[model samples]
Target: MTSPEEALQQARATYEEHARTCRQCHFDAVPCPVSKHLLRAYNNARREQMRANSGVR
Candidate 1:
């Protein structure tokens, strides 16, 4: 199983790469469907890491 930190890092990198290439990912504006999915993945990874750090299931 991947560690929470690793998962978060992977998710962040994936999202960042997409945002870098995709024109619809303006930080100030609404994201495209793909961007939205990626953002959700990143956020979920982040939350999982936080939960792990806090010893929460």
Candidate 2:
């Protein structure tokens, strides 16, 4: 298994890549409230994963 820090780094990298792709394709930055909601959901999930892996309980 990977360390928590490593996992967080990978997640950050993935989020950046996805955001970049969205910017290129949508060209509106946020595009729409619905899309923003989905992006926020993804960000929340990443945060949850980080907390789970950090062993802070």
Give all candidates' CA lDDT scores: 0.89, 0.62
What TM-score would every model get versus the actual structure?
0.85, 0.48
* Residue 12 local lDDT, model 2: 64
User: Pairing residues by index, what is the TM-score of model 1?
Assistant: 0.85
The clash count for each model shown is: 0, 0
lDDT of 2 by residue, 1-57 (tens): 865556656666666566667754367665555455555755766676768777555
**For model 1, where is the 10-residue window of minimal lDDT?**
22-31
Instruction: Give one digit per residue, the lDDT tens place, for model 1 in 35-56.
Output: 8898899999999999999999
lDDT of 2 at 55: 57
Best by lDDT: 1
